[model samples]
Target: MAHRALVVRGGWDGHRPIEASDLFLPFLERSGYDVRIESSPAVYADAETMAETDLIVQCITMGEITHEEVSGLRDAVAAGTGFTGWHGGIADSFRASADYLQLVGGQFAAHPGRAPEPSGEPRDDANFLDHVIELTDLGRTHPVTQGLDDFAITTEQYWVLHDDLIDVLATTTHPVRPWHPWRRPLTSPAVWTRDWGAGRIVVTTPGHDPEVLDDPNVRTVIERGMLWATRTASAS
Candidate 1:
């Protein structure tokens, strides 16, 4: 039987929701998933549609989700439906919905940029910075990141505000640059997973655009995550 995958995408255009989600369509199709794409979160409120879904891949950033919509989504995941996403699309989405944040286990706080010049002029390319995603012991052994070594990428490095409930796979550290108001270095989860009830969740803080996701290492991890955080994958 074919696995069911629903892709919920929209919100901020800078994240390239359509393109980013498109990158994985072929893979999902080849994986024997019957894919359905929705432009709005209203689809999440349809318990009937969500129930038939085996997995959900979301990519909305800074959007509002109604109480009814979030409730349906929360219930679906708790009942063993898998979910996975990356960057703002997942971590930065549904700012008004606390229940959504609790279910995902992480929230995007900020993305620190480079140091300022002597003139104190804002750099044109401030948000994107070079950082390495160092894998944890769990990442080295976990199916999501197995056999993967640390890799570097230049992009908007997310300073995520996350809880202890997530199984961290990789991390990135924020440097105490002169530009930012911080006394010491801080580390944030670059990639992580959570087991919610009978279901699983995966999130990556990189993927700001297609180029970032195109990085071989990032692409591999996301593809594996899409499969890893699924009801069928868990049962197997």
Candidate 2:
């Protein structure tokens, strides 16, 4: 049977939710998934729909989630539905919902750079910088990062408030910027996985732009992670 996947997107447009999600749709379809796309988190409120879903790929940035919606999503995952996403879609979403934040295992606290005078104003530097994603010992052995070497990408380095339960796969160091008063480089998790009941979760914080998703390394990790999550869910 074809695996069932749901792609729910929408929130802060600055993250280019539509374009980023579009890049994954074709790939999911090609991978033998019966993909369903929704623009709202309300879909989580549908118990029957969530039950039928094998995996959920969320692309929503910062957004509010209703209590019922959060409960529905959490219960579904805990019952063995695989959940995976990248960047703000999964990590930075549902800022006000602690339960939702706990479900994902991390919350985006900040990115270590100053925005222009007006927020969302385009800058030549684009609020991003070059950084290397170093694989953890677990990453070397994990299916998602297998055979992958330390790679570099230019994007906003997310400083997340994370739970210790996560099995970190990869990490990056945050350089001390003039605006922040950190005395040393702060190491942050760039990719991670955790178990929710019988389900699986995977998160990577590098796909802020479509171009980042185009990178072979980033794309490969996400694709493998999704497959791993789905397979895990099906086995459960």
Candidate 3:
């Protein structure tokens, strides 16, 4: 039987949640998963549905999730369902819930707010700036970044607080224009993975927008990461 994948997306229209979720449908289909896209977080309500899924790809940002729903998904993943997402879709989601943050491993603390554009408008476009990501001490070699070179991306170089629990995959040390308020040059992580019970979880800090996901390298890395994070990797 083909594996089932659920994509839940909504919150923060600027991230183009619906469009972002749509971008991955073909990839998942090509990978032989029956992909379902839903804009509502209520997808979390169906306990049987969660149990049936092989993976959950979420693009939700700063959205609400109910207590029962959150618990249901948590239990499902712990019981062996994979979980993965990119950028603000996962890292910056569920800011109000500590349990969610604990599961995901990072939170949106700040973005010094990007520098201004030529039109004198602040380029708040998170995925338009090309920057380098330096690998963390723990990221020299890992499944998600094992053979990858230092890549340049138009996406936001995510400077995140180190979560001791996660295994760093790749990082960027070069300072880009700050998007957060308190500014000082700081090296930042770009990708990482963690384990939740019998399941695997991977989060990429790239893919801030549709265009970023279009990068061949970025797209390939995330696609592979999703597959690796899911439980059916050996079968795939």
Error of 2 at 93 (Å): 0.3
Evaluate model 3: give its TM-score. Answer: 0.87
Best by lDDT: 1
Candidate 1 Cα errors over 4 Å, as ranges: 117-124, 233-236
Cα-based lDDT at residue 166, candidate 1: 98
Model 2 agreement with the true structure over 35-56: per-residue lDDT tens digits: 9999999999999999889999
Off by over 4 Å in 3: 113-128, 135-140, 174-184, 232-236
- Across residues 1-236, which tens digit of lDDT does each residue of candidate 1 receive? 89899999999999999999999999999998999999989999999998889899999998899999999998888888999999999999999888999999999999987766679888867789999999999999999999999998999999999899999999999988766789999999999999888789999888999999999999999999999887865543
Write candidate 3's Cα lDDT for 1-236 as tens digits: 88899999999897898898788899899889998888877887789888888899999988888877788778877877889999889988878877788887777665544565668755446335567765665555666666667777666666676578887777665454454444566666678888888888888888878988898767766888788878755422
Model 2 C-alpha RMSD vs. true structure (Å) is 2.6
Note the Cα lDDT for every prediction shown: 0.92, 0.89, 0.78
The TM-score values for the models, in the order shown, are 0.96, 0.93, 0.87
As for TM-score, the candidate ahead, 1 or 3, is 1
Candidate 1: C-alpha RMSD after superposition: 1.5
